[model samples]
Target: MAVPAGVAAVVREMQDRLDAMPGDSPLRDFLSTYQRTTTAVGQAITDGVFADGEWVEEWDVVFAQLYVRAYDAHIDGGHVPRPWRIAFDAPADLPSLRKVLLGINAHVNYDLPQALLGVISDADFADPVLLGKRKRDHEAIDGVLASRVAAEDDELTATGGKSLVDRVLQPLNRVSSKRFLREARQKVWHNTHELQVARLAGPAPYDVRLGELELLSAAKVADLLAPGQVLLRLAVAGFGVVLPPAA
Candidate 1:
C-alpha cells in the first residue's frame, strides 16, 4: 500500500552514495552490482517477497571468499585427464580484501532489516517492523477482488473450498511469486554470506554453526563456491552444526 517511502531497502540512499564516488575508486568495482542488488532487493520486498532472515545477508558473505576458491579450482580442476580450460571470471577490483574482510559493512547495516521490514507478517512474532503487512495485503487483495482485476488463470488454480480468488484475500497469506521468493532468497543469502564470512575472520575466536552458518558437504561447497572454495563450512563451524533440542 501507501508506505511512507524510506520504510524499506533504502535503494536510492544506497545508490546515491555509490554515484557520488569516483569511477576509479576501488569501491566502484563492486558498487554497480552492490547497488543493483539493493534495488532488486527493495523491489522484491515491496512486492511481498520474503525468505529466511539470514539468507540475503548470507549471499553477501558467500561472495567474500568465493573467488579465492574459484581461482584455485581453475588451477586444480585442469590437472585432470581432459584438462578442460574451465575459465573462472571475476571483477578486476573485486571487493577489497579489507571490504570483504569486513563484509561490506553497509550491506550488514541495511539489507536484512529491510527485507524484514517489508515482508514480515503479524504472525512473525519475532519481528515487529512488518506487522502492518497483514493489513496492507488484506486491503490490496480486497480491492482486487472488489474490482475483479485478477481472475483465475486456470493453470494450477485451486479447485476446492477456496479458489485462487478467495485465497488472495487472506490477510496472513501475503501474495508471493516464485520470482519474488527467488529474489528474496538471493538477498538474504547475499547478506548472510557477508555476515558469515566476516565472522569467519572476526575476533570472536569461535562460532556456533547452524546458528551462525550452515554446514555444507565438500561437493556442495564446490558447486556453491565453484572451484577451490576453501572449507568455509568447516571454517564457520569451528565447533560444528548443532541439532536443536527435542521438543
Candidate 2:
C-alpha cells in the first residue's frame, strides 16, 4: 500500500529535531544514517507520488511491491517487514514523516515475501542460522506490534473513545500483522531453511543484500540535510527530476 501523507510530515518533523542535535551528539552517526534513509525514501515517495507530471497516488505501493520482490529472501533466513505508524493531529511543525518512512521500509522488509511466493524458489529457503534469526525477530517484533495495538486499545478505553490508536487498532490491525509474520515464516524463512538442509548452504548473499542496504543508508543521509541546496541535490540524485535549487 502507498504510505500515507502523514508519513511525509512525520519525517520532516524528525528532520528538524535531528538538525537541533549538537555535532557532539553521541548518536549523531546513527541519526545521520537514518536521516539519509528518510531522505531517500522521501525522495522515492516524491518520485512516485509526483511522477511524470501527475499525482500517481499509489507510488509507495508500487515501490514497496518492487522492493519486496527484490528482497534476497535470504536475510538471516527470512524477510522482516518494517511498517510505519503515524500520530494524527500532530503538532504542525513536527509532522513525523521520517518515522513513517522507516515504518514502511520495515514492513516491506519484514512482511512482504509470501505475496511473491512464485518468484522465489524453494531451493533457496533453508538455512538454520538464518531461520533462527527470523524466529527471534518475529518474537521480538510481535511484542512491539502488540504493544502498539494494546496501547491503542487502552488509549480508547481510557479516553472513552477519544484516541485514534484505540479506534483504529481494531481486529484488522492485529490480523494483518500476524498474517504477514506467518507467511514470511512459512514461505521465505522455513522454505529457505529447508533448502539449507537439503543441500550445502553456501556463503552469504552479501553482495545483493549490501546493495539494498546501501540504498537505505543513502536515504538516511539525505533526509537530514538543510532545506535549500542539499534538498535539491538529493532530489536530483534520487528522482532524476529537478526542482528549483535551494536559494
Candidate achieving the largest TM-score: 1
Query: What's the lDDT for all of these models?
Result: 0.32, 0.35
Could you tell me which 10 consecutive residues in candidate 2 have the lowest summed lDDT?
81-90
- How good is model 2 by TM-score? 0.27
List, residue by residue over 1-247, the lDDT tens digit for candidate 1: 4222432324454456556766655444334444444444434444554442233333323332233233234446633111111112223333232222122222222233223333432244334444344324322322322222122212113323233443453332223222222333344434334344334555352234222322221222223223321223222322111222212
Per-candidate TM equals 0.28, 0.27
Model 1 misplaced regions, further than 4 Å:
1-4, 7-9, 40-211, 214-247
Candidate 2: regions farther than 4 A off: 1-104, 107-148, 152-169, 184-205, 209-247
Looking at candidate 2, what is the lDDT of residue 132?
48
True-vs-predicted CA distance for residue 7, candidate 1, Å: 6.1
